[model samples]
Target: MHKAGIPLPNDQVNADDVKAVQAMSEKLWKMDLAEQRVALAVLISLCDCIVWWTQRHK
Candidate 1:
């Protein structure tokens, strides 16, 4: 995809990206349902805190 003749770099891949995929594949995505639910709740709370902090700073 391009905007104003500048192409998006969606095809880019780096070592960190590869490692993150491998880690998630070996851990989070392989978790049982109950464990996954707990993980999801934690992620939600973390995101909420992030948003709150950003808004407070702004």
Candidate 2:
């Protein structure tokens, strides 16, 4: 994802996050186009939630 220019979570990210992302990426590559789109959409939604929560808390 970094190689693809996608920004990763920065604040408070830990080893588990890295492992999970790596694992997800491995599976993501094996997915068909439609499945990949859905996966990406879900990822985007998660990011949105993170951003919203962060802003609300700060």
Candidate 3:
């Protein structure tokens, strides 16, 4: 998997999580340049939501 350029999370990472991120990145990369930009924007938005949620919980 590492040879295939799959990304791994930190020391506490799980197999399924790595696979999921790999799949998401692959799908994003397969898009056209404009589409990929849009996809990335969406991803950033989602990440922001996650961060906000985590902060709220704290």
Candidate 4:
């Protein structure tokens, strides 16, 4: 079973939660354009406060 989203009711957050999200997001990125588009639509619908960052490589 997957436990990837939201804060636990017990108020415990783990590094694994962050890692799971990162892994899932990376997997979503590697999906086909059509699949990614669908995933993005779902993601946008679920967001309240969206934050993103970019790093340019030299």
TM-scores for all candidates: the values are 0.55, 0.52, 0.50, 0.36
Candidate 4, lDDT over the whole model: 0.51
Candidate 1 TM-score, true structure as reference:
0.55
Candidate 3 at residue 1, lDDT? Answer: 22
Best-fitting candidate, scored by lDDT: 2
Q: For candidate 3, report its TM-score.
A: 0.50
Ranked by lDDT, the better of candidates 1 and 3 is 3
Q: Once superposed on the true structure, which residue ranges of model 4 sit more than 4 Å away at CA? A: 1-16, 41-58
Q: Which tens-of-lDDT digit does each residue in 1-58 have in candidate 4? A: 0243322223334567987667666665665676556655667865622433222321
lDDT of each: 0.62, 0.68, 0.63, 0.51
Ten-residue segment with the worst summed lDDT in candidate 4? Answer: 1-10
Query: What lDDT tens digits, residue by residue, belong to model 1 across residues 1-58?
Result: 1343422223334667987657656665565666666656766999999999999999
Whole-model alpha-carbon lDDT for candidate 2:
0.68
Off by over 4 Å in 3: 1-27
TM-score: which is higher, 2 or 4?
A: 2
How far residue 44's Cα lies from its native spot in candidate 2, in Å, is 0.4
Highest TM-score: give the candidate number: 1
Worst 10-residue lDDT window for candidate 1 reads: 1-10
Candidate 2 ranges beyond 4 A from true positions: 1-27
Alpha-carbon deviation at 42 in model 2, angstroms:
0.4
